[model samples]
Target: MRMRTKAVLLIVFLSCLAGCGSREPSAQSPQAASSSHADSGEIVLEADSLKLGQIRTAPVVVQAAPWDEFETPGRVELDPNRVSHVLMPVPGRIRQVLVRLGDAVQEGQPLLIIESPEVSAAVAAYRQAQAELRRAQSALSKAERDLSRIRDLFANRAAAQRDVWAAENEVAQAQAAVEQAKAEQEQARHRLELLGISPNEPVQQISVPAPTSGKVLEIAVAAGEFRTDTSTSLMTIADLSHVWITANVPENLIRLVQIGENVEVELAAYPGEVLRGTVRRIADTLDAETRTVKVQTELPNPSGRLRPGMFGRIRHSHGLKPVAAVPPAALVQDNEGAFVYLEKGRGRFQRRRVRAGQPRNGWAPITEGLSPGERVVVDGAILLSGK
Candidate 1:
């Protein structure tokens, strides 16, 4: 029994040794270790491996193009120049509102009717002034006739010379009165014209016309509501044929934006639809509270798809600048973002994330991450990327 136990123990020991030998880690092999590290993105290669992979690196260069870029939040807004506010023309009850909110209107189109006493008063005053003018003219005619008869009598020696002089003075006084009456009549006529009423037809109602052609954006007063405040706006109308997309750019970044420059806008409501516009306006003063400058881009919106207060983003790029640039082979894109293999000396390559812009003319401007004069793996970068 003892001899059998010793032979069994030897067999067990040999079997344990064989299992340990089979479980040896692949790290023992240099090639296997390098392959494993290559899959991890960062590369550390030996002299032979570097030469075998045929890695070629090029120095980052300066490219004069749209090298600097940034995106900011934006919004759709109404153009202030095209916006019109309707105020109460006269103090009266609003008898009728001809248009509703969102309704299109034309210039000089009547928008409301008001039963105002001002119009009637103007017409009455005009008529009274006319009658007074007529009476003065009749009196002047009688005086002139008397003066002429007195002059003839004096010439024939049938009347005193003082009588002719006195008659002439009376005629002069009558003429002056007629002139004063004519001035009064003119004043009354002007008042009627201002009230938009005719002396021939006296009416208490006055129609208010639109000052400008546009779409009615708001209505503050309703029909039958008496308004005495003519200074307060009763409604708002704006020309929606063109709209302004505004974005508040930081005070530091305002230098990149200017009037008449083109910009690309994207709205959240319409994804994947890019709208292009020109910068038509920029605030002269900066906001003290927000420290931002309001910039507006005008876009032709004949279809009226863009509405005010719609949120979006504004992308602006300034003139060409000297920025770090690399070739397309140097850039590697994955789920995270675009990156490049930066070549450090001594067969060492480091992976770095880059803010690369659109590729242009075999060069991708690197807005961030890489710098000019730095070396990056351009050719055979795929070998270092390890898939």
Candidate 2:
């Protein structure tokens, strides 16, 4: 029985030894050790492996580009300089509206018609002036003939000298009256012209023409409505082919905005499309309540896709500044934030955390944690990231 117990003890001891041996870790090969490090986010690729992975490296360049920029909320607005306010030239009742709001118009195009008694009175005065001028001309012609006949009679001693002098005086008076009548006629004609009434045609309604070529933005008059306020606007027209993006920049950053500098514009309506513009104007004064300065950027819209009141984000680039930059594709984001792969040594790369600034033209400016002349993994960064 003792011998049997010894055999069982021996078997137990062997079982324990086997269990401990199985629990011990196996020695890792060099490839396995390298792969373990790579799996922990420390990628050490050999030159051949990098070639097979199609990895590309580029030196972090010191670039002088638009690195100093600030984004401000803005909105598209009609360029006030290009806007036109169509006002009533005279008090009249609206007889017809030739165009509607938002209708494109050319200069001198008839926009509306108004029936005004003032227009009719102007035409009547012009006609009366014409009649008076004709009458004066006839009188002057008669006086000249009389004066000639009197002079001939005096030379033949058939008329007195006093009568000849009186006839001369009468001729001069007639000439003066003709001059006066001509002046009145011209004055009347100008009045008719100012009223937009043709002197040759009978005046019925005054046709109001557009003073400028633009799109009608507002119409305050309707057909049959009497607009007696000559100072009030009848319509508002705006040239929308070009627009202004008005941004209220903070007072502190107002000095950064320089007129004539190029700016980038992005509208909420069209995502991923960038519109280029130039800083055209800046307000001389700041808003007292908001403590902000108004900056205006002129944006051309040949396609007329941009409309007034559209919200936009304006990025004003003051000027170019030297900064460390890398290809935009090198940036990778994860829970740790934006980062790039640095080529630490030959056939080796390490992940680096970076604070990226605004990107321009497929290049990203590294605001922090990067320096010029360092080589970074531009292509195949994703391969390292995935591992």
Q: Put down candidate 1 lDDT per residue, 57-130, tens digits, no spaces.
A: 99999988663455789999998999988887678999999999889899988888898887787888888899
Q: How accurate locally, in lDDT, is each candidate?
A: 0.87, 0.87
lDDT of candidate 2 at residue 41, scale 0 to 100: 62
TM-scores for all candidates: the values are 0.63, 0.65
Native-to-model Cα distance after best TM-score fit, residue 80 in candidate 1, in Å: 2.0
Score candidate 1 by TM-score against the native. 0.63
- Candidate 1 residues lying further than 4 Å off, grouped into runs, are 1-41, 44-64, 67-71, 133-187, 190-195, 260-262, 271-276, 320-349, 353-364, 368-387
In model 2, the runs with Cα more than 4 Å from the true position are: 1-64, 67-71, 136-180, 256-258, 316-322, 326-356, 373-387
Cα deviation of 226 in candidate 1 (Å)?
A: 2.5
